[model samples]
Target: MSGGGFSRLPNGTVVVAVSLPSPLGDGSVARFLVHAANRARALTRLRNLGLRAVYLRGNAEPPTPDEITAVLHHPDGLLWRLQGAPAAELWHPFRSSSPLRNRWA
Candidate 1:
């Protein structure tokens, strides 16, 4: 997770940037150069891990050394800079015996 290279997706394709919420609950985020077949699959990976993600516009291609360093050195992780319509903002509601799921189903 600490490397500058892209992470492989489930389908073995390559994407550029992915913004993942921190599992550590330290108010920090994790940014990855993601490898996915497409945007939906990339998002599915994060969603399965119970994470919300965004794609950074500038890093949507293979990141340069400076871009890698900049993301790593970012104070609040990379969530702050990810913007645009292509970004995925997924919300997983708390699991419970609530009737919402049944209604939707």
Candidate 2:
């Protein structure tokens, strides 16, 4: 388990941020942010997208306001990046296969 949590928008929507080990077994942790109507739906969205073991139990690494806006502005309302990677690194959209590869693995 990396870190994860949820943040709700004033409009009643939620942004869920979770950091998990890359499913690709690349030994790198990747953070996923999902914007949805509710926290449950947000996590479910990721599960449906192929992160089958997804879950949120504590508010350890909730999305910051800026991060929420980034996901909301994105076409798919979903974004991901390597854990602790430089802010200059681009956040990738949801892909069946991860985009992190082994750069930080």
Candidate of highest TM-score: 2
Our model 2 lands, by Cα RMSD against the true structure, at 3.4
Which runs of model 2 end up more than 4 angstroms from their true locations?
24-26, 96-105
Q: State how far residue 39 of model 2 sits from its true place (Å).
A: 0.8
lDDT of 1: 0.40
Off by over 4 Å in 1: 1-13, 21-25, 52-62, 65-105
Residues 1-105 of candidate 2 have per-residue lDDT tens digits of 668999888999999999888766667788889999999999898777767778898898889887888898998898988777787998888754655432222
Q: Give the Cα error of residue 62 in candidate 1, in Å.
A: 7.1
Query: Which pairs of residues collide in candidate 2?
Result: none
Model 2, TM vs. native? 0.84
Worst 10 residues of 1 by lDDT: 76-85
